[model samples]
Target: MAFGARARLINPRLGTYFSIFAALYTALFLLVLIFEQLKFDESFLRIAFLAGPIVIYAAIGLCVGTNDILCYFAAGRRVPAAYTGLLLGASALGGTFIVAGTGAFFFSGFDAVILLMGTLTGFVIMAIGLAPFYRKFGAFTVPSYLGRRFESRGLRVITAGIAAVPMLLVLSAELRIGGHVAQRLVGGSANNLVFLLALTIAISTAAGGKRSFTWTGVAQSIALFLAVLGVATTISVMVTSLPIPQLANGPMVRGMVRNEVNEGLQLIKVWPMAFQLPPEGFSALTKPYTQPFGSIGPLAFIIGVFAIATGVSTAPWLLPRVAATPGVYEARKSIGWATVFSGLALLTISSAAIFLRDFTLDAVMSERLGPLPQWLHNAAAHHIVTFDQAATRLGFAGLKFDRDGVLFALPLLVDLPSAFSYLLLAGAVAAALVTASATTVSLAAVLGEDVIQGMSWEPPTTQSRVWIVRGFIVVVAFCGAMLCVTAPSDPLRLVLWALSLTGASLFPVMVLSIWWKRLTVGGAIVGVISGFVAGAFAIMMGEMGTLSTPGAIAGILGLPVSFALAIGTSLMRPEVSRHTVEMVRDIRVPGGEIIYDREMQRLQLRKHSRT
Candidate 1:
């Protein structure tokens, strides 16, 4: 039995299959590169190469289809820690992280580094505060766990509604960015590209559910990691004559800062005081380019960091990945691995942004309105790279940068081979699709299992439940795609909006539910609703185009109100049931599998009995 368990964990067949697929795709990519170099107008070849991998990935997902809800929902609770970690990290590193986040570093300078730090610290909070317990509780999803813990269907339904907001918003942002990438690669309508990408995601997600996303996420992570590392390393070597960009790019950055100052381009003090913003009327003062806290002062910056950290800790899509792990120990270990992966990706992205900025400055200064590079012209055509030549004498004129364009524009900015640019775009697409699929699954799970099932008069049959979940995947994907077409906010801002909502509304109650035995259903519901209202209002005020400071401090406004209301209301109300009390104790103990194992057996028995 021990040997069989170990073999199952190792899953040699899956490993071999993945290795073969990777080699095949790599060979195909190299072939396409060669064709391009031969001057064969490889537009068709490039599209074929890019589209083929996605189809193959979807086919693999379909091949792995399962009727078991346990498998569909949580991969049968048998995935090893390493795969779980990779999937979680990949899912977390969405299109926003890959495509728009680099632009953020270009725009916000070092202030954006705070957001990255908050994300890493969030995983630490998850590993220590949430993952082990959530695994031990053995719930299929976060809302389901909340319902069981609080012994209230209303709480489950409300949590589901609240959770859906951020999931849908984030999904829209992912689709929007994915569309931009597809447009860059294929040269088509952005809306059409989004619909196609959404269709692809829906098909892949509906076919194998969480199980498919797990394996595909591993592939996506590898592609993104390699693409980022390769681009950043290559650019760093070209710029500073050093291979390690994270270290060597400092001098380049310093040189850029000196040039900007000498040219009378407004810039804040470098290092330590990088939080200061440039004066108004600077062309670079776009959305996030404004003061970090607007009028809320420095304390708002600290609040923003904690808000993002809390959001990452309690995000609906991420919680299910942690629950899929086989045991508490593996769940905790998976978060550690996830942190390492995220840290490496973050390092690469930051370095890439810095290097690109320096490269762009040098290019513009050298060329000075004498016809820019081909990549810049392409980007300008797409409205990604704009130029403001009104102040050409300042030597910083003619360059208006958008954060969303930095990653995709980097290859062109440095004049790398066309094949490398294609590879990077593919990486961005992988990141977007992987995240969209995971979010779709999580959204479907919550809406179908938690909302629909909780509101049902009778328990849904296993087959009916599976169908409902699959149906929700299509519906959610369509809605997200539509929003992608209509939503006006940039990708990074959309992501920040979703995170701020989650941090303000869900994080407070989620933490207390596990740590505070006295937390009553009334308190949980009240806190969540109040936080949601406050957070939404704050966000709306910011969106109304009148209150910058209110939006910057939106999380601060909602979080404290929710925390206080929850604690105050819980003290006024009665404590929860004894079972709930003991469950809390159960989560804190280590190396236990009886709870999850029994749950799995129960699900298996139900699946077999129904058939």
Candidate 2:
């Protein structure tokens, strides 16, 4: 039994499993393509496209599931930095970043780049300041690390509860977005699809925990990249007669700028102009595609970036990937790869937006327009964009596009084969599933391991612990689905709320725990609670119209308050336990056995002796 278990832990045979999945999906794609050629019903093809990858992902998860605690919890700590990076990158971007970010870029133009910039900055902060230390500490969850570092189980439980808020918010948003994509593909009520999506995610997460999450994440990322590249490349060839969308988009942007000006379109002043408005008044047309600061003010832009970057760096869902790496150096390398992969996708999305905007301008502004263009009708059929032909003229002002649906509707707008449209939605669904699964898996680990142990003062047996986590996965996934279906906010706003709350509540306390030996339980508790309250209040006020500022930047107010309270509280209680000081010193070293593993062994030994 020992030998069999050891072999199972040592060898997941992930490459073979992925190869099988690849073959299966390729066959499915060919089948769908044949049906398209044969003029089969469009709804049938849409259902196939939406459901095929999901079934395969679930199969992969079930195949990878393991009863061994190490394999289930952390993939036996053997994943290479590159694979870990790919997984992290995919999860980090999620459905919201790919779908909503692209839509925001399509509409907001240069203003959206500010958010991307902040998200990328978060990767740098994680790589430099957080990932290595967390990996070196070797906790299974963020709350676990906090509990161990502070030497207080009560603090662990509190921190676990606090961390769940942002992660849950993110989980619901991803599910909501996923359901929306499904609804577009299959023409059904989104509420039912959301529950279905939640069940699928829970099954995958519960089956193998992070072990399933890692390989599936890699597969999902590759699929998303392919879909994005396919649409971008096709559109680029049409626009610039070149294959490289990122490079080709430059000329197209310039053309759009010149065309807009010639048509008497002026930049839309998104925020009130600081001084008098320009002679070409704001009401006439859309903003120039390349113009900056027209959609969002500089102050809000800066605040949004800062808040998002900080929150992303400390996100609880990301740290488990760090612990899954082989060592501190590997953890750092993993985050570096995450940055590269995410940056590549972001750049591709940005270029795609420019091409899309150029297409929209041509369709509306061309003199040859006789009836509403086929592209507009096609887009309208899917409810991707709204327009009133009787009330409004044929310009940007006449159409109000759905930000969530813009990327999904891109292929149809370009008159590509309807298959490409399904492919784009497939990519969006893949991203959503991977992120939702990762978030569910991480939250399960927090609640099952850290929260449970902190409350009970005694760890359950390994078998029971794995089962407990599996149960929590189902519970958490369903709760998220219910929230998304019943009371959904904009996916982008939900993401921002999650980020702001995370940056405010956890970041300051977490950073101090790593860098400051004087950080006490009282300080962490006060800082987390205070920051969380301050950020939540700001978001509420912003939403209620009580505060003039945008809700996206509300977390900024919490950062300073958190830092001051934590620092001052620690100073007032200056006594430091020797063991905690040594633990702090030990985590900073890159080369050492995992501290969490050592502590676990001690605990197990003590329990055995007591028995």
lDDT of 2 by residue, 144-194 (tens): 888888888888888899899999999998998898888888878999999
Instruction: For candidate 2, report its TM-score.
Output: 0.93
Error of 2 at 270 (Å): 5.6
Candidate 2 global lDDT: 0.81
lDDT of 1 by residue, 1-611 (tens): 85577567556676777677777667766777788888868578668656976787778778877778778888878788877887777777788787766766666666666667778888999998888888887777788888777768898899999989989878988888888887778787989989998888887778778887777667776677767777778777776789887788777766677665444456343332122322111135322222243322355556667877888888899877987777788899999988888877877888887766665665556435655456656666646667643434324455676566677666776677677778788888888888888888899999898988875424467798888998998999999998888874566666677788888888888899878889888999999989988888877876575655435336436888899998899899776778778877876787565454464466667767887
RMSD of each: 4.1, 4.1
Candidate with the greatest TM-score versus the true structure: 2
Q: Give the TM-score of each candidate.
A: 0.89, 0.93
